[model samples]
Target: MFEEWSDRRTLRVFDPPRPVWVDMAATGMAGGFTPANTVPLRVRTSGARLEQRMQGWQHAWLQVSDGRWVAVVSVRLSSANEQSHASIPLTVAAGAIRPAESVTKDEP
Candidate 1:
């Protein structure tokens, strides 16, 4: 799925073990971002709301200026029944994503 945000673009990708409702090999990605257009990302969803998680694919961070934006995508394994599905969105706290800075010892 795709989200056309005013600033940045958001696209949800399901790296499922296998395919089902969505054709693993087929989706009209006309003028849109595809897996080939992917970039490295960090994800978390420990305390995310169901409502936010249910948006398939969307941008959960706007004012946030640190971590990779959250992408809420649905997931289902080929072995499991269709009823067994979930919305896994990358959850994160505000301003929590940043590179760790090392501290150097000086004359204290």
Candidate 2:
């Protein structure tokens, strides 16, 4: 949960109905990047891969994709039983995370 990259898995953001703040560079900042400086991104209910985890000095962060970091309290991983299906690569840009490939291949 802290100080490691969780296995590549799916997760959904439930709280903060709006898109969550991201530390584009994975920097452990106090308030994260401001809206004016960067576009906030939302995780789809369908979910996306869990990338990396960071135990910051004051906050916990999860990298949902390359260069996309969200606070731990904002999102929840798809339950182990519910995430039996595969998660394709995500296309992140301008506050959205879309599946890059149509096919969903199980992780090896």
Candidate 3:
């Protein structure tokens, strides 16, 4: 799944261990700022894939840009099952600096 906010982009993917539904939610926090709304992520899979007797995992990537700042969040799920759920908490710094090397530039 992909999401685009005012100045951010987010991507999420799921790999389930069984043919069940999984839900995911995330919230953002900053000083003197309460958390925003919770976003629900839904995942579905086929039974054949679940019965294959193999390990499963899920991946999620989130990127946030607030004009002067950029942030990223990555999530990994292991052995996900029917009752699997993930809650992620995000913190935004008011005056943090990110190294230049950490920013990805367009490939030549």
Candidate 4:
């Protein structure tokens, strides 16, 4: 069973058949007025994966190594699919993960 906490806007997480692990990250954005272009030209998606060791979500312990990985972004398909790509770098220290800094931004 599951429960919804509207006040927190978060769902309760329960144990699944297997352990939940996060290895990659992705994002998407879509807007604009395009009557043509047939498909993409208005939407975009980007994703990237990390290498080396980063684990232990219990306390969020991550031991990442310095490396670089390729990241790719693609627009959702309609009639014509458009894609853009890029490479991202990972700067990690060999130790427990540190709390990420918070950023303030307006909603899209």
Largest TM-score belongs to which candidate?
Answer: 1
lDDT of 4 by residue, 1-108 (tens): 223333322222223211112132222122334354564434422322222222212211122233422211111122223244332222222232322223111110
lDDT of each: 0.28, 0.32, 0.26, 0.25
Residue-level lDDT tens digits of model 2 in 33-89: 335335323323243434343111112334565656644422233423354344122
Error of 2 at 108 (Å): 35
All-Cα superposition RMSD per candidate:
19.6, 16.7, 15.3, 15.6
**Candidate 3, overall lDDT?**
0.26
TM-score comparison, 1 vs 4, better candidate? 1
Candidate 3: tens digits of C-alpha lDDT, residues 79-106: 2344553323222232221223332322
Q: Lowest-scoring 10 consecutive residues by lDDT in candidate 3?
A: 46-55
Worst 10 residues of 1 by lDDT: 47-56
TM-score of 3: 0.17
lDDT (Cα, tens digit) per residue for candidate 1, span 41-62: 3212222212211112222334
Q: Residue 102 of model 3: what lDDT?
A: 33
Clashing pairs in 1: 44-91
TM-score of each: 0.19, 0.17, 0.17, 0.17
Candidate 1 wrong stretches, greater than 4 Å: 1-55, 62-79, 91-108
